[model samples]
Target: MESSLLTCKKKISKKCHVPRIGTSLSHFEPKKRLIVGTKPNIPDLNLELPSDSEEEEKDASDDVPKLLNELEVEIFARVSCFEYWKLQFLNKQFSQLLKSGEIFKVKRERELVKPYVLMLTSGNSRWTMVDKSFKNFRRLPEVPSDICFLYCDKETISAGTQLIVVGKEVESIVVWRYELELHKWTKGPSMITPRVMYGSASHGTDAFFAGGIKFVEKGIPKVCTEAEKYNANTKTWTMICEMHKRRKFCSGCFLRGKIYVIGGRYENGKNLTCGESYDEVKNSWTLIPNMLKDITFKSSQSPPLIAVVNDNLYLLETSSNELRVYDVNENAWKRQGVVPVKANEASGWGVAFKSIGDRLLVIGASPLPRSFIKRMAVYTCRPSPYVEEQVWEETENCYDGVELSNFIHNCCVMFA
Candidate 1:
């Protein structure tokens, strides 16, 4: 265990000054509440960073350049996802650049993006929004789902978002759409093939739900090869091709332009080592060349969390609590870095993970002497071969008031 990153959160007194944007230790915890901020909240999607006091401004100017050009702003904007949200407070110029989507445009053109984690944790089954600091949190509507079936985060460059939520309902699987921009929930088309614990991934504009254990008897079930695709725009689902292997409690990731269905267990209490990819152009599924067997260096009770970052596939091995990177071009696996110890300790039940911008965001719990504490860990994923150079920053003691049994159902990262 790394004691350097694990410690109690410091509580601030009344009338304390706000910390600077991008400050690592900016998180503040009060008596029974987690403060989002003492500053004014953003009315719309165009959020402004907290204002700096005069003395703080003087200190910043003395240490760093006062003015930033467009290129400099772009460079700073690409640095941190949570911090990037706070950087909007730097100046009027910085505020305008972010509000006008100029910074995001530069990032998209340069292939740079900052991801914000939208997580679903089980405290009475509620939702909350937090910035990079992870100290401040705002409550949102609960996603109307019982069993986590399929969930995904999608964003539009114009500044809005949606989280597609799906789950099992008695004899069928229900679909619900949560529009982030409107903060409203509406029922969507249900799955043609009702499935639970299925391998799902959203590619392009459609959501795909694949292999899962189909309910036949009261308790005993059978692995399924059936799959379907749901179009968010049309609010309709069209049956798609089946996968090469049947899987349940599996993981799916969209890479390049195809969907890869990774490791999951079947009815025989055995996990599938081989994986496959679906190509819409060919309307078929092709074997992925024993991708899971080649890379699974640890034993995971459930399927590992798989994601695609910068054309490469990354997996979080829950058992070993290590992050591994796989280059699609090289078709080889290598050690990237270890997940934060706090997040690893929380993975005893399961961990929620997603790729935000260039970093990997993980949400898990740290067991304490009396109870458990939920925490979020962020890691920078560099495109370099030197893995040791990467950095991991954690935001612990989040959702402190929530009960520990509120296990994570699902989590996704969205960018506005």
Candidate 2:
């Protein structure tokens, strides 16, 4: 299975085109600083020169005129994070401020953060970061790992400003993180128990990973129940309590202030209908049996397609292309409506389903007639379980003319 996926990825990469970073503030000409007046040739002999300390103070105040440095940072924090890259070109101070990630910290404290979608499309080695509007996007630097890691099946999740990609190399499983502030990919800070096909979800600066397959002696695969938490701020992973049942190909989400892992097969190759919820304060997992009992299972289908928006858990039924909302109190799923995308195709493979802020975002091949040529379709809807039909709005011209494959290898949303 892994070898076949790697071969498919290799073929896709060959046909992909790496998009250049989009232009920002490029049209406007630089405003030349004006010289109001020339210095006088004759100096007053009695005039006392300013002290070194006084000169330094004056320069510091001039850094942000009429505002203290803290106030300047506060102002910048309120601005959309997508425009932050352009701010670096303003001056060295702005560049330093962005690189320091101080604005992001301020935005978090002030509750001014916004979600940006990061996607690794099929045939594209580099990841693309797109704003919530999907109007502006920039290509991220390619991961610096070897071809083995590059073409292998990978899982992506975002914690704070870090985008973490977990995959297998020739010798071992590797963790590669793309730091938004640094705008670079760095390796290490791997999971406590390195594994793949695990369920992962991010909350604030911390991300949780649980229940994946790990290789034992001589490449023998074994299902694992071990769970771990990754703190992006500290760049560290801490072991958490294991789940009741061992699982692989499970899906995870942060809902109702808890991390929920749902629907994956056990080591014995039997599908699991139960779900588990982890409580950080109690440091335990609560097993919820038949969490996915309503949904039909397929042997060759991808892991459960799920996302959370407004603390409501939603599942995309791949067999029917229908959307269902989980009722926490009732412990059952409520059918919303059919998704516009062709999720049923390929058994939910090559599709990106995620929550972007208040809206549920779905990217895949459109079921519409014009989708015959394989043009990727992007749609978003404000999902409400109370409503019978979901009104999905297609985000036209959002791809910036780049031909992206409908097959999304990995996708995650980073709120920074």
Candidate 3:
């Protein structure tokens, strides 16, 4: 006789870009608009998250245990790591699972949701899916797929409350945002210039988009020097000061309200050794000294993931997996830590932490057509040993008028 008892698996495995409609205002390429074509089957409304069925919540004894501890969370999260297994069945069973609230769910707003890190990466443009967070590790695949190897022309996180994703499909920059708690995505205003491979950073509610090359022809594009900004409240974009130089495949992060755009390859396709700073208050860009070591704005597909902690910027070269810190106040760069594993950026740029205090989590994905991982690898900012621990404990010997021994014997069993 064959056994028929159902057993649920723990740590299920995982699986696997842009907006059309951006441009580098400079060069004013008429053909810079990217293709914003839609697929035949893409639903008008795509839904993500598990349903809070009345039945599931009502039963406690029959409830499935939630893996919330850090280690357990990471393990189950690593299962589909880069959306490997996710893409496998996302079409059918996954669809039903999501619709029925079986796969993933949203946190209650009333409950204090512990702040966690969020890292975003869009996969092959053909079926691009946004790989998010190592904590909850969700596969909310709704991004439009355009071509084969589509990349994020640009991306920005709004206080981690929303994801302001703007990118170029072929020429135009398409804009979309993911509302964190709601677990839903909504369309937003597009950029005037469609840019590919640009840098973005936000201060308060206003987001800034800068740099990125615009395609003028099939195989030719020019690095742009234009800068633009978008405000969530106004839902509008305003053009601002352009950079002193043109560069693409660069990275940027906000430090103490200043946007530091750094180290992207020049139009010449050479790694950029120099960087710059942009101040919105002054509406100007200030040229900074060249980095101590050379950093090419090559593709994010490789290394040099830049992130910020306490307004301090740092870079992680995937090629070396060596962590380097850039002290904004000191105006200097120095090595901080090293990653334990070697990360490949072949598919695209590895993810940099936008939320970790100062540690940036770097993740990458290569193809494994035959394996579960069709694309994407997941790794977090190997935590810093130097971070301070301020875990506070509340020692209550007894409630208002209760005795310790009385309560202990009443609620707990003491071993003999």
Candidate 4:
């Protein structure tokens, strides 16, 4: 019996023998191996583990509640203004932070302000506010006023966050302001000398209006040289030194830290080639004679189509549809290139030419074939005074299927 047991034990020991190092185990039946000090082979359960990003987000969500409100505002202030609308919808705290205008104040302190274009096209009583890319736009609330004021010829300019529209009512010339913060229109804070077709310009938080026609006792239009400075924060207008010459239908631009009024007619109905620049330091006007003498004038032309970019003045000559840059030292305009739009068709009536940041923006009816159905074209160019030819690129239309009239009645850029 002992010999038989010994023989069975020997057989079992041989069947369970450990394979030598570097030896093949192919002859053995396939089974998971278990080592003495290591974990046994186990099937994968496919469990999902939290990723680093998800863990970090969880940590931030947990930590946010501990931050103070002032610290929260400081954090939100660094966000882009384009995301503001979305942030306002996050919670009541964020909505109140934006509504209180504290974010904008912080942005101003950090020099993070952005520019928006406010334009009133023909056949449209409401104004359109668009971003620099023209990708996003919203129609402003309609001005609550008489039909005469809505349909009449109006002048628009922006200072700080206020868009001021000046138009003639049945009884008087009135000022209607669109406050961005309030998102509504309010009348009053009328100009000291209410006028139309004036040369207007904006700088920082102030807007300057000068040299337009005003109605007198008999409703007869009389040209004037009076100027006024409007403070957006104070919501008041104070009279400033008058221009050197009485100009009507003039165009104004802020250049080299001064307000320049260019290319308008005198009271005698004769076109004036001279321009004037207002120096805030001296509080006086410097006459720039023969500013427009080199360029030809049309029989009935609109005001000089001018814009300032990088402290340089540019003109869109409507007669020839030519883009010219002013030579400060020579007092002459050097032709840059021919514009794509037909500015001469209506003598620059329907075209919108203005500066947007470092680029010059032009919006008007395309010169494409009529079969194209007269689509409005939007083009922008980064112009350099030294470059002989400017290359203009078309921007994507984002009017949201609204067929806006190509005739832009009022357009202005506001940096807020």
Candidates in order, TM-scores: namely 0.62, 0.83, 0.54, 0.81
Instruction: List runs of model 1 lying over 4 Å from the truth.
Output: 1-114, 131-136, 143-160, 216-220, 294-300, 342-348, 366-389, 396-407
| Ordered list by lDDT, greatest first | 2, 4, 1, 3
Give the per-residue lDDT of model 2 (tens digit) for 1-416: 33553465455444332222342233111111122345534657999997985454332213333244465577778887667778777668878878888889999999999999999989999999988888888999989999999898999999999999999988899999999888899998777899999899999999999999988899888999999999988999999999999999999999989999999999877889999999999999999999999998888878999999998999899999999999999999999888999888889888899999899999998787963738878999999879988999999747657877888999999998
Using lDDT as the measure, which candidate wins?
A: 2
What lDDT tens digits, residue by residue, belong to model 3 across residues 1-416?
A: 00211111232211001112332334223223322334344444566544675333332222233422222333222233234245435455334433432222222222222333333333222212222332223334565545521443444455324556655565355777755433566665667776767877766556777888776676577899998887754678889999987878767767776887877777777767677788878999988877635432334443236666565666665655566666555666565555433333332243333344333444433223436343333444433424332121111221233211100000000000
The C-alpha local distance difference test score for the whole of candidate 2 amounts to 0.85
* Global lDDT of each candidate: 0.59, 0.85, 0.49, 0.84
Q: To one decimal, what is the Cα RMSD in angstroms of model 4 from the true structure?
A: 18.2
Q: Number of clashes in every candidate structure?
A: 2, 1, 48, 0
RMSD of 3: 22.9
Model 2 weakest 10-residue run by lDDT: 27-36
lDDT of 1 by residue, 1-416 (tens): 11311221111211124544654342323311333556654357565655674234322323323232443555654565445445556566656655554555566567665345565665445555565445545555865554443232211111124466666554455666765434556675666876667877875346777898666666556789998887754667788888877788777878888988888886676777778889988889997765767544334465667767676777777667677787666666677667664444544344666665555566665433324344333333443444643466655536567433335656665553
Residue-level error in angstroms, candidate 3, position 5 = 40
Candidate 2 local lDDT, residue 341: 91
lDDT of 2 at 215: 84
